[model samples]
Target: GFVYAVTTADLYIRGGLANRVLVIGSETFSRILDWSDRSTCVLFGDGAGAMVLEAGEGAGSIADHGVLAASLRSDGAHKDKLFVDGGPSTTGTVGHLRMEGREVFKHAVGMITDVIEATFSAAGITAEDLDWFVPHQANKRIIDASAKKLGIAEQKVVVTVDLHGNTSAASVPLALSVAVADGRIKKGDLVLIEAMGGGFTWGAVLVRW
Candidate 1:
């Protein structure tokens, strides 16, 4: 979600809609979870993240410090695999989060990597070119598999799932904040952010911070 948020903000700036944009991703998954369903409750948490995107000068080179490229993809066909069971109109109450765990894990890695690969191609940079890889904090296995498949080293990946469960929309940005605070992400660093969520939505953004 935050991956696409960055892209949306970047486009807004480029299109002259605004000189600055605040892209925010906040989720309170705990409220919607059914505690009885251990599969869902144990994996999600509340979190918020925001980043400011302001107009900036670019040198028209790889050294440019801004969003370099982005790719977003979604398929409703897989919506049933991971989705809430209720909505205001559908059930008059916020539905509990529901997911086919195996299905989500099966599709997550592939969909995430696809968009990341596309973003990397669009940016004309490979995984090795990234100084930081802040993917959505889904789980360790998915993170490890995606990075391994992309050939991004373990050192370049920023992980915080152990600390912040699955923050849904807040995943990518929350991880970014952690990495930046710890000095892993710095100015002019080529950072790649990626995310996949319950709507079967996924995206990737390559930004030079």
Candidate 2:
């Protein structure tokens, strides 16, 4: 999938695959030393995106298909929790990614669990069946809470937020590449991907190697 949007990090990226509803989080604002009175650059920097999901089977069971099932959800009430103020009409520009970090973090944890649960229920699976549980790598604490809520094994989660610093949609696939290179996500393994972002959009995807 290819899209045009002013990234919170001010990056211009186009085109990529959406494997299930992989969750990739962006926390670009955390790097800002000052969260107040920076008219030049508001709380922009953090943003995230997920892959465009497509279904395919290869003589695979829930453990064989590239993606078995997925779910998505969002709430408008939290719209202001995180957002950019500028737009094409206002400044003839893409605004910065401003947000209430604490608030969004709170909502993220709860919503993430909901999305994963929905995926599991729809797929008729359980946490025990998951080989890898990757969440939007926005905050370590958030990742911990969501995984814990879903009863996912600690060993099954892969974290790339530290190195990538939340490339938004790029996070999930980037980490997948890492695990693939490291020989962690072997063929036929069940992988779960999830993420939450600006529009309060969030979802999960279940895939098999």
TM-score of each: 0.95, 0.73
Badly placed stretches (over 4 Å) of model 1 are 88-94
lDDT of 2 by residue, 108-138 (tens): 8888898889889988999998889877666
Q: Which regions of candidate 2 deviate over 4 angstroms?
A: 1-61, 88-94
Candidate 1: the clashing residue pairs are 188-209
Question: What's the alpha carbon RMSD for model 1?
Answer: 1.8
Write the residue-wise lDDT of candidate 1 on 69-153 in tens digits.
9999999999999898866455435678889999999998889899999998888888888899988898899999999999999
- The lDDT of model 2 is 0.66
Give the top-scoring candidate (lDDT): 1
